[model samples]
Target: MNDEARGAFATRGVGLAGFDAPEARGLPPAATGVRVSSASDTVSRRALAHGQEQLRDGPVADACSALLRAAAGLRETDPAAARRALLAAASAAWSAGDHDSYRRVFAVGPCHLCGAGCASTPCARGCPEAAWRDHRIGMSAMAQGDFRRAIAVLEPRLHQVTPRAETDELCDAGSVALLLGRLPLARRLLSLALASARAAGAETAVPGIIAYLACAELREGRHAQARAHAEEGLVLARRLGQRNVAADLSAVRALVVSIAGDLPTVRAQVAEVLAVAQPHGLAQAAFLAEWAQARAELGAGKVERAAARLAPLVQPGARQGHFGLWFLAVPCFVEACVLSDRALDAPEMVDLFAVWADLGADPQAPAQLARCRALLAPADRSEELYRAALAHHERASGPYEHARTHLAFGMWLRRRRRPTEARDQLRAALVGFEHCGAVLWAERAGAELRAAGEVAGTGEAGPLSSLTPQQVRIARGVARGATNKEIAAELSISIRTVEYHLRNVFAQMGVRSRTGLAHLLANVDEDHGRGWELPDRG
Candidate 1:
């Protein structure tokens, strides 16, 4: 190729040396008919090797560009070598956080490094190049907020990794799992990643893994544990000068504090998170911080403010598509919208949440969807939707959400003039909120209870109070006429377990039949005045 033509290719970030002379379209030949020799090939190979070495040690983007140039130079003369160089370039670009470059290079087609026809066989098992291929695909999917695809790409290869696999592999898999609402699997994988990072002294990996663990724990309703993990991760990230990680950890802390009803602390933490995240282009951190700030506003009874803050986030917008954490914000946004008397805004939010509900495979999605529907549904259907939401929330094992559902249901019941039934749900909400350290919610529940003319702690112990949270849930299910099998399926537990819990619930509530159980639970306050007692099976 002529110097001008080669220079043009280089300007476009393509290496021309690897292009065969015949295939160098739009390029003029050298001034003289110069024949390429083996000596020239050797020089090109040396240059490619040097680029590869730089990829391993130097600045990633520069190394990536150099490697891509080398790959282009060898593309026609040495296809296999060119493929290897391109793969190295893609890897370097990904490592440098240039996902666009990675995708651009991979769009050239499957190479030996990614296996023949790799893009079409994303889920193919046992391919020799599966690990690297899936990792690249998974990371790309995650960056695009296509978490279901990311999980599908990563979960299969997780067990195949040897002990030598990088801690990031585990961290990425765990994070995808958590986003999918596979909480148990996420917890297990994140725990392993944390252990692996600590053992290998991978200090840089520790903070990100810990941040994920904190999120998992938060979803699982282990508030204190979540806070501790977030605090530790935040400290480590700041100490390591990992500004993005610190920003993410700060956002996590904001969520924790918001749930705990410390609005002031939540606001402060969100400010810190946004200060670091927005300037650094940390989209995930900024999204989370804004979500947490909205939650804080909601908890503080600033309904209009919360609704305004959350509206843009839940609506179809630039920020909404980039962050898959929208699932976590939906319930709060739905409530804020309804409470602010802007129920018209709910349809779009509900539609967006419904899309996630369909794709997320999260255990909590059904309950959250039901809750959103309850908020948007007409008065005639709202009660049924609320009941369905509560049942699903209980089955999903999110105590904080379950409590919030109860609070919503209690408020609804109170408005319907069923104060006695309202008090039952309010008391349950109060207990759950207090257990989760959601002080504001607990106080709200307490206030609702008082407004129902039920003196706090003055009535005889309600039969529901003696039951475990699980039993109370089962009792409510039975009251709603859900069979044990149906309850089992919804909760992701065995029918036998549901049956056993129902029996305990029946015994505790002094009811021998489902109908009696339903009646007694519905009019629980009637028995409260009579001091109903369970017959001890023990």
Candidate 2:
């Protein structure tokens, strides 16, 4: 329990005339401190808001009031329960939207900044609208891959926004809007913000503006303009000495470079960005940049490395909050699963979409979610998912985003052996990648094209061009017929997983059987580090 609670209980004597509750005598009381702590921040505001409702209909006030007390209990000792309380409070606030309800439900809950009257101090200070609260909630929702919900949580605050808020929060909202294809909204908000930032000479805001302008231009299909704007942002970020902003700008640069088909540069630069961002405590920047880097590794013929680097960041637990949490995490996770040769199950869009509905973001998330499902579904189960992803992307309206969804569809089609449809998707994806400077992605698409016989460029096969010393060891083992089990045992894998990798090796190498693989393997020598020999099935 917290000091207050300990003190509250310490009055065990009952004889007191109350003398400032004579300081609790002894050690720092080893309990978790608060039944729920940080209650003063995110949760208390919600409680205070709940109090407002109690003043309204006596019944709800009682229910929520009781809920608030219980939440306080949880707040000091168990934050998880506290968060649930806060979320419930937020839910009630939405249901009520009245001054009392809004205050008790959101404003007075923990995580509240400034004061219950946060709106009152817009002119004098830090962050208008108290963006930290909204952004945190929105980001938490997004990190769970709940963009529709994030928009819901964030939009009310963003709409008719006052220039008094921090620039990053505004930029974040615009970025999410652009990703969702709320074009008209994105344009209005972004344009206003950009103009305001520029006029204010807030150089820090330049990067945000650059992002908005580039993203806006890309949505309009003004591809070249998008590139230029992104480039301009990078320069401006450097001029301002804002490493985080520069890193974000560099991510855009990587995207642009990827679009230009400069795969090597895209690979190198994204890695640099990841390296630069990881140590700065800039979790959002690090996660985003790392994701791009992993994708680049796949494009560069280093599949294993990509898998290791990406798996954690995309996991839901690893990305509880930040920004674009879901939109950013889901696509990258899905992409990682497919490229890394794993089944797409846990946390698939279908599952995540359900969670979104429960959270009450955009109601349409479920319907749009069906699109991604159809797109990823078995060939026979797909017409629905395909249309959904298309609709979702169109609604998202950003070409870069649309292209990614299309690329996923192409991967599905290719898997289904519908080369014609697959080629169309792959081409569109490459164009998006090319258009957005996702060079590494374009390279992968080029490989798929060659595999489909529409073109003749190496994708992940024909040679191991980008393998590092570690990968060379692993690849050589596969080339020598070492099963993942044997390779794992030799390199240390369990029997089952050995078979799993064997399947992937065949698919990645474009071979149907061991003999065929052996034939392909003959071209390489031990110089790069050969793997253990395999037992011939023959």
Candidate 3:
């Protein structure tokens, strides 16, 4: 251990020199004030201490065992402590991919002592105890495929989580919320826990919370923010000697870079994650690493390579990746398969993706699923599917994906000898890609536009072209004669933000008034042969 790690362990009363010595087993030499009334208490305390040491050192599977022992020893005497220990054990087991150990932790009922279960008590809504109980029951229900019950039990509990909740309770609730695909709720709860943990100097908890927070941001299409948090979390995890958390953070970085079209960075991050994740049985991290690599390949236009890379991860049976994450790769897999002349191999994955999409967790899934179906549909039917995909994209915040749909539809139109229609979609796609910093995708769309007999515009293509996705939406709202408050409510943003983007929109479009902006947009729509629809305020 390094000086920093030793110092952290020292704060827990564990000395660095004799951590593994038989005589230094229970309560380190620095421990003096601890009270142990019974043999079980002493053993439980020792086991808990040892488990924490192992977590900070190496071999998390062993840490799970130690924590489980601690929980069992304290089950009857110290129910609260036992519950904490068990939750810790479950986390360790999950990281180590120890299925039996994880199941064992969950099998120990919601309450450590009460056989009547957690519902029997009339606890206040945001209490730490109630939060923990809800987390446990919700997780168990999810494991059992009772997703409806799980969401019913956990969604309300997420709202109940407050700054007053314990760090562990907050982390557990946030993680559960994330797994259920509630990105906003997960981000809010995890961000709160992260701030609280940082303020409390809880270094051990910060890395994990940051990992989850990065994932939530990633899912929400905040790629830049996700990468920033992932990088910070990686540094801290490595410094704290938490290889598993470091691997997870590295995987997150890989995903972020993959979307940004940084192939070299994606490969490097995936390599770093896999070197630790594969041997440590960190399947979630490993899955992410491999998925990111495939995504990078797809973005680089290596269709066959991407399809081959994703095969094992998304296919059924033992070779498949993490259950929660495998479906995420299915859209890419379907597109790759179609592009590689292996369309027959895509239906199963697309069906699976649709099943998950129906669960309504991932906001991008519906549009992506539509695109996948469009890829597999006949040319006669593909246009309607692509249109449906675009309609779905209007409701979500993922510009990269929305652009991909436009790009695909444009490509399809070009092949059908409809250059004019193709040019419109390709132009929108190029703008979307450029606005989102997807350089490779933007180049692809530009090339398509050029091939369709149009010189790609050097800078802004039109008045609305220079505006961002949000800016464009706000401009459209003005054209539709909706007030800033109406647009803000429709977009779930503050009216202040709506006004801010609107001012930028007006400035960019060279229009001082909403009436002028609306007239300008109407002229552009007539020239372009398409209409930009805003949310219907009526």
The TM-score of predicted model 2 comes to 0.51
Q: Output the TM-score of candidate 3.
A: 0.72
1 against 3, candidate with superior TM-score:
3
Residues 1-538, candidate 3: write the lDDT tens digits: 1444333222212100000101000101112235445986988989988887665445677887888788767755676777667766766665654545554554424332233244324235555455555555655555444556667876786787787898777776677677666778878888888988998999988887888788888887787888899999989988988887788888888887886667778888898988887666676678889999888877766667789999988776677665445677889899878776678999766766676666565788899989999989987889999999999999888788899899999988976889899999999999988877777678667766765768544233477667655576678788988877766543434689899898888787888999999999889888878655442444
By TM-score, the best candidate is: 3
State the displacement of the C-alpha of residue 42, model 1, in Å, after optimal TM-score superposition. Answer: 18
Task: Please write out the lDDT profile of model 1 over residues 1-538, one tens digit for every residue.
Answer: 2444333222222110100000111101112334446766676577678766554334556666776776666655675576567656654553343535655564423534434464435534666545555555654454444566766875666556444556766665566566456787778778888999999998876876787788788777788888899899888877876666677677877887887667778878888976865544444567678888888777766666788888776554554512334445767888877776677877765665665565555677788888889878888999999999887876777778888888888877876789889889989999999998898777667756765666544233567667654465567667767666555433334688888888887777788999999788768746554422211111
Q: Which pairs clash (backbone N, Cα, C closer than 3 Å) in model 3? A: none
- Please list the C-alpha lDDT of all candidates, in the order they appear: 0.64, 0.49, 0.71
Q: How far does residue 156 in candidate 3 sit from its true spot (Å)?
A: 1.0
- The full ranking of all candidates by lDDT, starting with the best, is 3, 1, 2
The sequence of per-residue lDDT tens digits that candidate 2 reaches over residues 1-538 is 1444233222211100000000000011122444434544556545544543332222332434544554555544554455445444432322221123323333222323344333212222564424545544554444334456656765675566655655544554555555444556666666666777877788655665676566566545455666677788878766766554566556666655544545567667777665655554334445545665555554444445555666665443533322223333444455444444554542343354344333433323444456445545666777657757677656443555566666667766765668898788878888877765565456556545544447543223345544322233345566666545434433222457556656666666677877776666665544445433222211
Ordered list by TM-score, greatest first: 3, 1, 2
Query: What lDDT score is found at residue 496 in candidate 2?
Result: 70
